[model samples]
Target: MRRLTAPLPRCALVLGLLLTPVGCAEPEKDKVTIMVPWSGTEFKAFYAVVKDFERDHDIDIEPQVTRALTQQLDAAVAADAEPDLAVLPSVGAIAKYRQAGALSKLDVDTHAYVQPLRGLGMNGKDVYAVPVKADIKSLVWYDARLTARPPGSWSTLRDRSDHWCLGLESGPTSGWPGADWIADILLADEGVGPYTAWASGEGRWDKGPVKAAWTEWGDLVAGARKGAATFNFRAATEKMAKAGCSLSHGALSAMAFDSAQVKTDGYTYVPSSRGALQVSADFVGKFTGNRSADEFIKYLASPRAQRTWVNEPGFALSADNRVTAYDNATQGRIAAMLRSSRYTLCFSAADAMDPDVSAAFYRAVLNYTDGKDLTPLLVALTRVQRELGYTHPGSPPPPGPLCSPPNHP
Candidate 1:
């Protein structure tokens, strides 16, 4: 029987069908399907592991790839046709799913895994999803050819203009990069307490640290050294790759080390190099009635599987070290930065707000590109922040009487 290691190739399927027997005993009935959210090369890399899963367990596995993974899962569950496992990118929903009885808690000993991943499972308790791929976001990528060493803090980043470039123009998520800017400033200047409070909705946007975060970002944007408003992430990244740009901020996954235009040695990586690292938690949901579904989940958390699937070469970092993983020198530096993060928070894109609220923030930012008033933008954010219910994770509910909600003109 052919071994499965990664995503199945179409050619392999044809060969499998052709080789199956005349009077053969029916194949062992271990069959499963796994769903994931990302597309393109990412899907390809993850599918590699799916191939491996099937080979080791004598399982016949199918992969369902979709861009709207959350929506697809919801539709499937509603139709009572949910797959055995689904990969998600939200811990808030994971908590809510457990509360809603929609997901089973990952019941197993995780003693051998990394300690930081304990809460990473379900609802501060049950282990539901085993982390697969992780990108450390606190890293600052700089052109070593130009600056040699990048600045450490927000102050240094803003004041020292030896060289800096940021692609704030990621479409759909253009404002998201701006959000990262705000998040990092808050994390660096105020610490986790204030950032957590804000994330949990108990903290006010106009409060000192929150305001300071916005002010800092505003000051940076309006500073002496300016970034191209129209440049998307790729442009800034390309510049950094060619050593034309001195510094850029992004996740470890953003820059590929082998890009032809990039002079690999020109890049330097660091944790908190840009700001406090935030994570986009990806998880898998269980809905299969198969007795062996538990086995699959356990394997996902196993050291052997982790090494082959999650931590394998060319793949991104996994949250826990179920097994040793390797990366090239540049990627290793990025991983080191992620592994050493002190203040890891969820990305704002993962914040529990109506997508429209986020859209509003984005629109306001795009308007700011045209030199719109900062006060109006702040006022709009305060409203959006209030109405959408800003919040923090792992914090006690706010104390004292509630203040009157702010209004936007």
Candidate 2:
């Protein structure tokens, strides 16, 4: 016969129950990693959106910020250690990665975006990327206290070099500011046909409009090149008052002033009368084919997210037509220009060129700013274009129109 086991005391039973493991722990949240080049306030603005996404979906977002985005990304891809997504400012890089089979197709709806913006990052019918932020580069910022009137023409603007503040240094992208000036000058002086042709690589760089545009920019900023090449672009605007620089040419986002301080700082801007305003966008693309990553990209392209992002302190513009309102009058005016059918929009030429070609272009600008001759530089660029098969006679232009016509969007 077996003896009956003694029952545990109530307190002991309760203690045993408490000590036993249970399934009460919270489940792990899904995670998505994104590589981005943003820092400071720009990153903060972007992170605001990331937090919104995280809260809505119960996912964790890990952002890897770096100034050398291109180099780091290339290495990551080679090692098969790429992030789930990346923010690419260079459309050329998007195309490059897509062609190399490194990018996963995007399923985000882009109907709200305007023409070329909708068309960018498309490899045939497959969408590889979607623009998350946009900026208008065709703007001239000035301290109203110092200037009675903004320059009405390029000639007048060029003649006022003493009042012009410029800084070409920006780490790996040092000469891009100069490139913007040249592209705007080309589009304004030569017209869209030539600008598009040259940008697409069909036109010769050493001849015609491209050379003229380069020369024009050289004349405008060469005098200021002494310290500008090494000077940081962000600091250019801040030192304007003390440096006697009344005029600064760049996107509002590039200014050192915050969005709230724009109107109050006595700084104002005018749209470059340049034929078509130069515009750029930071696009998001998938790399690891993660479902959560796809969701994040979709959220970023959504109208709600776009609206939220533009209202932040970063001064970003949205390509989404649904994003109409802005927190301040300055932003509202810029947004209206972006949506208005009256103004034509052209993608930034350097941002759209082949990565190698773009790198060369940047170097050429910096060298030219240092008093180097422009002819050899143009010849070298033309040779590079030819070798890349962009300058072959009867060669087809890049798939889509480089410059969008007014009202086309």
Best by lDDT: 2
lDDT by residue (tens digit), candidate 2, 1-409: 1233444466689877887655566789989999999987788889999988888898899999999999899999999999999988877788778768899998888877876766876767778899899888888887666776676566677776355687888999888888888988888887788888877877888988899999888777766778888878778777775655767887843447655557564677887764578888898999996899988999999988988898877888898888888886777787777777777888888887876788889899888888888999999999987866345553333546667852463
lDDT (tens digit, per residue) of candidate 1 on 1-409: 2565444687789778878764476756777787776555566666666777777776776778876666687788778788888886555455445555667766665555432343445455457666556655556666555665765787666776545555566544465566666766776777656766665555655657877777787777564124445666556666655666666665632444443223255456555534445544455667766756777777766666655654443436555543445534555455554444344434433233334455566666666655777677767777776665434343222221111111100
The true-versus-predicted C-alpha distance at residue 333 of model 2, in Å, is: 0.6
lDDT of each: 0.57, 0.80
Candidate 2 local distance difference test against the native = 0.80
Error of 2 at 235 (Å): 0.6
Candidate 2: C-alpha RMSD after superposition: 3.3
Q: Which prediction has the highest TM-score against the true structure?
A: 2
TM-score of each predicted structure versus truth = 0.74, 0.91
Q: By TM-score, how accurate is candidate 1?
A: 0.74
- Give the backbone clash total of model 2: 0
Report lDDT (Cα) of residue 26, candidate 2: 78
